[model samples]
Each structure stands twice: as structure tokens, then as C-alpha cells.
Target: MSSTAAFYLLSTLGGYLVTSFLLLKYPTLLHQRKKQRFLSKHISHRGGAGENLENTMAAFQHPPGLPVYGIFQARTMEWIAIPFSRGVISAVTIGTDMLELDCHITKDEQVVVSHDENLKRSTGINVNISDLKYCELPPYLGKLDVSFQKACQCEGKDNRIPLLKEVFEAFPNTPINIDIKVNNNLLIKKVSELVKQYRREHITVWGNASYEIVEKCYKENSEIPILFSLQRVLLILGLFFTGLLPFVPIREQFFEIPMPSIILKLKEPHTMSRSQKFLIWLSDILLMRKALFDHLTARGIQVYIWVLNEEQEYKRAFDLGATGVMTDYPTKLKDFLHNFSE
Candidate 1:
């Protein structure tokens, strides 16, 4: 209540405001630019689920069940009788800069590429991925529904579940974003070992939204880049709003997040309660700040908005200074990016 105390308080508040504004406008002032090994502006969600069966070999490479002839088999009449399949396009061929997929641990400690822990939705089998060995895994349903796009189904010739190592061998050069769906130490260890074995430490990004999982992943292999966990993201939003973001040292390299508006659209306003809709709208307003995005980019962090399927959503993400847009429809996104002027 003293005049001197009030004066000091006002001075401190003014100084903090000025510092926050300057840092928001120019984040490089405090943080050194981080060196990124791989940059992607077009990320395929679930290996372009809308274009092919999600996370299947057909989604990422050649159709499964195709036989390779050995040098001796080349002389066999069976090689000549085999028919060649056409019109099967892979996600890499569709011009996706990065592939976004999830991982789960099989019963035999193998890492498989899948989004859900349960196989009912994708494979139509009521079993946990961890309960089955890699070979015991069932084939995917003839027609699986796309997660992001409701009521839309995608069918492909290759319905077999693929091992993570197989995907690495198939697409060694492509950058991949791996989401650890569960808090399994063995799964994390296996994925880390695979990354090291494949020498893809620079090109692979792996983490889970759970802080515990992310920490374990980093401890397993600190060289590989990590996506922000849910706790870190919440802390980041808090710091950004409190004008203390610049003072903080961000360790994560990628900020992969969902666009709130797109999420709201997916939830369908008619189906949401008034309070749910309002919270989503409020999150949209708070998280969509271009200044926050620009500051993160300036700090050498790539911001990727995920699961955006439509062209308009892609345009919105790019317009808001997103580093990339992850979508279920890679072909559609490729076309949009091709025709995009900016």
C-alpha cells in the first residue's frame, strides 16, 4: 500500500509486458535456432487412411501377397503366369512428405503399425494387439471405416498387419511420425532399437501424449526427435497466455496438434451439448493465435496440425502458419497443395 511498493509493482508489470511482447514478436532473441534434420509440409495420417486401408502395406508400399521371384524361380513358368496388379498407389508415391502412424506391441514383443490397441474396429476381431503374436494378428476387415471421416470406408488388397521394421525397410528414406499408443516400456525399447538399427534417428519422430511415456521414450533414445506430450502442450498454452513462453526452454522439437475447429466439425454441433461446444469454441479461440504459432516457428519448432481431411481445412492450417497438415486423404491433399497458390 506504500507509494514506493505500488511504484515498483507497476514498473515490474510494465517490464514483463514489454519483454513478453518483444519475445512473442522475436523468439530468436532468447532461443537459439534448433537444427532440424527433416522437414515435412504434407504428412499422411494413418498412411492416408481415406486413400487406402489404414496402416496396411498397401497404404505405404506395394500391395501385399505379391510374390518375388528368386533367380532360380525366374526360370519357372509360375513366374510368367503371375498377373501384375495395377493402379495400386502408395502413400509415398502420392507425394506425402511424412507418414504419420501409430505403434503397438504384439504378444511376441514385436512392434506393429496400428492406431488402436483393440482390433475390433480395424480387423473386426475382439482382441487386444498385445494379446496376439505378430503372426497371430488377424487380417483387416474387407472394408474399414476411416476414423476421421465418419461413414466413409476404404478397402485395399493388402489387409495384413505390418511390422514396424518392415515399414522402415520398405520406406527407409521417408520421414515417419510414430505415436506410441500405450505406456509400454518394451514397446518403447523395441521402437528405439529399430530406429537405431535402421539408422533413422534423424528422420524418425516418436512419442506419446502421456508425459510418462514421452519421458521414457526420451530416456530410451534422446537423439530421436519427440512430439510434445499432453502435459507439455498444456503447460505451453499456460506460458503463452501468461507471457512467460520466451523465458521457458522448450525441449520438444515437434508440436503436432489437432485443429480445434476441425475437431468441432467432426464432433457435429447437433450432437454436442451446449457446454461441450462452448469449450471447443473457446479452445479454438485460445489455441489458434497466429502469434503463438509464429513464436514457436521462430524458436525452431515445427507445428503440425493433424487429421484435417478437407481442402478448406488444409488452407486454414497453412494460413495460420502451420508447418504441415496431417490428413487422411493424402492424394486429395497433394492435389490441394499442387493447386495452392501460396
Candidate 2:
């Protein structure tokens, strides 16, 4: 075909592709409104639960099976696994049903789950956790100086880095949320497969989701609760071609707003503005993300804010009508829910 003819053919095909994508993705998002309302109505806002412990980035273990909120722990976390696991295992053992972790592949392609694309902060060693072979990798506990005997509480137990499969085997019925750290489609596919092998109840997944990875996920299994965050979608569009992100049929858009940090305080310079802060979510958004959050929530998709550690902010997240707030301390969330419901 002539160059002009080839160009025309490709352009026509691309238009058809974009149309098909919008119809699939947007409608699923719209339909989620009823589900969102149901979730909002019944889920708790406060519990009479006791005073809670401070948590780090690793595991936020609560007792299993209570549907409070998913505990978030980053794989790129700096705390050693033993001390980390002490917290993580404790986080889950209490009552939390879900955990979010960052998953990436090493240079050898073994999946080493962690959040940062760079590992310098977490490992304190000069390396990307994703770029090292399992053997070349140092004992992770060495960095934290936490002894395995104390962390695992076993005389002869090994403290090697836990595998993706091992987590599934060890914690039956444990719900997981995996955030893909790299742009590898094949790696996401393998992780998806492993999720299927051990998935007993439900799983949630998110990522920077290069088009290839999200596309592969939807084509293979549509039932897994995949989230297409509004902020992330707009981000990918800005970063890549507009023609790309629309191809995936996403049922939910996880609009995550992290609780305030020193970084936020530095920029905005306010304290009582937390309710304002929860709405100030999408700090990464250079655009009007709050307007987008209202639009999405109005349509019925859930908007979950993360790490609502303080009582005032937790109350504000609910008062402002958020779908859910993720917390390191589910006990506090339960108390908030019970009191709110009363």
C-alpha cells in the first residue's frame, strides 16, 4: 500500500479502537454506583476497639476476616523483614483482611516484591531490589540488624525473603492487593497467574499498568477486582498516548488519597485543613482531581483514602462522604465506624 493509504488505514482502525474502549470502560465505572452506595451504607465508620499501636510501612496485620479496611504495607519498606514480619504478621493476626504490597522482578526475573523502582532507601544498600539476582542480594535483615530468632521466634527457622507463592500458602484466605512496580507485561502476567493458583476468595490489584499489562489482565480474567485510578489514568494519558489507556475495561477507579505527611505540610502549610487535605488528595494531580473524585463518586465507583491515622482526619474522610478509608490500624477504623453508625 502507498504511504498515504497506509496512514489512512491505521488511523481509521485506531478510531474504531478508541470508541470500543470508552464504551466498555466508562460504563463499567458508571454501573458501580449502586455497589458504591451499598458499600458506603453498610461498612463501619467507628469501633469501640482499644487504643492502637503505631505502625511502619511493612505489614499492618490485624486479625483475619473482618471487613474493616485493607492494611497497606510497601515492599520497598526500609524496616527489616523480621521486625517487619513481626509487625506484618501482627497486623494480619489481629483482624485486617487485606494488605497492599509492591511487586517487582529482580535482574534474574525472580519476582521480588517491593514498591520502589529504586531500592536505595529501603535496603540502604546501593541497588535496585528489582535488579539483583536472589543470590547476589544481601540478607535483608542485615540492613535492619533484626535477628531472625527474635522476629520469627523460631530456633531453626529461615528468614529468607518470602516468595509470592509462599505468602499465599502461609496465609490461607488472605486477600492481597499487588501494585506492579515495573513496566513489565510478562511479569504482571506471571503474578496474575500465581494469584489465580492460590486465590481462595478475592484479590485486588493496581499498578502503573503500562497498557500491555492492564490489557493482558482484562483479557485473561475480568473477575479480579482491578482498579483504574482516575489520577493514574490521567497520568498515563499525559505520559503516553491518549489512544492507549482507554482499551481496558475497568470496573473500579481506586481514587487513593494518602493521609497527610511532612511533605504535604511543607507545601500547603496548614493544620485544620485536613478535611480540606483529604479532599486535597491527588497532590500528584496538577489538574482538578477533587472535581474528578466528586464526579466518580457521584457515578458510584469507590474512592478510598489511605492511612487515616488520626481521629479527626478519619472522621473527616467519612463526613465528606468518602467510599472508604484505608488504615494501618483497622481497630481505630472499626471504632470510628461504630461511633459514626450510632
Q: How far is 156's C-alpha from truth in model 1 (Å)?
A: 1.4
Instruction: Please give the clash total of every predicted structure, in order.
Output: 0, 23
RMSD of every prediction: 8.2, 12.2
Candidate 1 lDDT tens digits, 181-221: 99999999999999999999999999988999999999999
After superposing candidate 2 on the true structure, give the runs of residues whose Cα lies further than 4 Å from its correct spot.
1-93, 141-160, 209-213, 230-250, 257-263, 266-300, 329-335, 338-342
Candidate 2 residue 309 Cα shift, in angstroms, is: 2.5
Q: After superposition, how far is residue 245 of candidate 1 from its true place, in Å?
A: 0.2
TM-score of each: 0.91, 0.56
- Which residue pairs collide, candidate 1? none
Candidate 2 structure lDDT: 0.48
lDDT of residue 283 for candidate 2: 44
Tell me the tens digit of each residue's lDDT in model 2 across 8-91: 999999887776456434645424443421232211111111111111122333323323333232223222221122223343
